[model samples]
Target: MRHGWEGAVLKLFRGKDFTFTVTGAEQVTERYRRVHFTDGGLLQTLGVHPTMWVRLWFDNAGKPHQRAYTLVDPDVEAGTFSLEFALHDGCASDWSRKAEPGDTIEATVQGTGFDVPDPLPPRMLVVGDPASLPAINSLLAVAPKLPATIWFETTHDSDDELPFRIEDHHDLRTVPRPKMVEQVKADLQELVTADTFVWIACDTTTTRELTSYVLKDLAVPKDRVKSLGYWKAA
Candidate 1:
């Protein structure tokens, strides 16, 4: 007999793990790539949300360096998920760079991030570093077609910078890396209106600074602005 309510309870208590075999890898740019997984039918059977953050484990130096990545373009009907990685000089990046098709890795489902807010505001502002682009793009995909501004900062000036398409209702701006936080702040101070909702994702320092400016300096309510620290400088 298929375990029903008890299985749900057991899943919550015992936690289920997902193992995926890399089916394909495509380099989209010098600093970005897409990896496709072809395992984890059980996780799909358990009904995992598309936006849920998953912990990935790769065999590197006999220690699993865990990193959080958003599930991109999950096809429940097809039993697969796509994870986009931003190549950097780190443990996860090293594994991703060397990983090939048919390689098996482990992952676990965890972490929920910002969902679109209700009673939607008239305008929206999204600001983040290149690492946070996937989350921003996912938000934009589901967001109602409205006037939105996205500010992205990256070290390289390349045509293939970000992977996703911005709707016509969205405006995108790019700046160099070192001054991204300041530029975003200045943009918000000038462009933000009473009906604007601001979403920010960046390093810890940037998140703290921008959160304070939006809440204390601009008097935007905490509810109207959401900020998250996607990573921190070492």
Candidate 2:
């Protein structure tokens, strides 16, 4: 399938394209699915990193639509990884719902990289939701020894059933959609430290709001916080 204009733009930016073949699949919950794949030389060509993601091209009513998904459990030696889908009414979710062992999908690897802080922070604060769960899991996995606190917002009742890599030292807080931002605001000040690392990835508005608060109000250094708006709220 042609990737359309998005492909053209990525190509100009030197993005690497690969074809992934589905190896297996599992239903984690009514609203979540995990699909396994063999990474068509992507790992060997570019290697792997924490929180690595790829843009997958899908067919949406005869038009090429692309969605970004984080690689779950990426094994460079095995050349394989899994992608978790928060099931919803969209081309990406539609493709995942019917994915089979032999199915193939085209993916582009670009604008996907992560660097752990040069000197690891004393503590890590992560704010995300189901949409960014895979990234959250991957990020935490890289720093298992670090003490971290996570605020995960839930949009569905089944969201609590989603997998999270919370260690004994980690504090995991679940907040409903409506109260997530407010709850974080009320509680975050106490958690901030001189070198605390704040990572935020959620709906655009929430990410922007919290990033602003952390930088302007809390006076955290700009380099200590990594904030990305994962999806725009409709």
Candidate 3:
């Protein structure tokens, strides 16, 4: 299948193309699924980093569609990786819901990056939801020794079954969708300090608001905070 105009634009920006073969699939929760794949030489080519992700190309009635997914438990030597999907009403979710071994999918690598803070943060503050869970997991994997506090938003009861990486030193809170921003804001009013690294990935509006509070209200340095909108709330 051809990637169409979007692929053309990505290629113009030096995006590298690859094809992934599904090795297996599993259901983590009623609302979450995991698909395992052979990396199509992607891991060896560009190398790995914390919160690594790729743009997966899909067909929506013959038009090109793409979505970003974070790599889960990538093994460069074995050339394998996995992706976790937070099921929703969309083509990507539909694909993962029925994905099976032997299926192949096209993907592109572009605009994925991460840089660990120069002086390791004294504390890691993370705010995210199902859509960003895989990236949050990757970030935690990269800094296993750092103490972390995670505020995770859940929209469904099934979300409780989804596993989150946790260490004895980690503090985790699972909150519902309503007014999660307000709760997080109230909690962080006294938590922000000079030695904190704040990471946020959630719905667009919430990320924007929290980022503003972290930077403008709390005066945390931009370099110490990483923010991204994983999805747009509808």
Candidates in order have lDDT scores of 0.74, 0.92, 0.92
The worst-scoring run of ten residues by lDDT in candidate 3 lies at 57-66
Clashes of 2: 0
Question: What is candidate 3's CA lDDT for residue 85?
Answer: 95
- Candidate 2 Cα outliers beyond 4 Å, as residue runs: none
Cα lDDT of model 3 by residue, 151-223, tens digit: 9998898988787888998888898989789989998887888878899999999999999999999999999
- RMSD, every candidate, angstroms: 5.4, 0.9, 1.0
lDDT of 2 by residue, 38-139 (tens): 999999899888888999999999999988999998888999999999998888999999999999999998899888976788878999999899999998
True-structure Cα RMSD, model 1: 5.4
Model 3, TM vs. native: 0.97
lDDT, model 1, position 73: 74
- Which order, best to worst by TM-score? 2, 3, 1
In the predicted model 1, the residue pairs found to clash are none
Candidate 1 residue-wise lDDT, 121-172, digit = tens: 7777888777777778777766558778888877775534568568788888
Q: List the residue pairs that clash in candidate 3.
A: none
State the lDDT at 121 in candidate 2. 86
Q: What's model 2's lDDT at 5?
A: 84
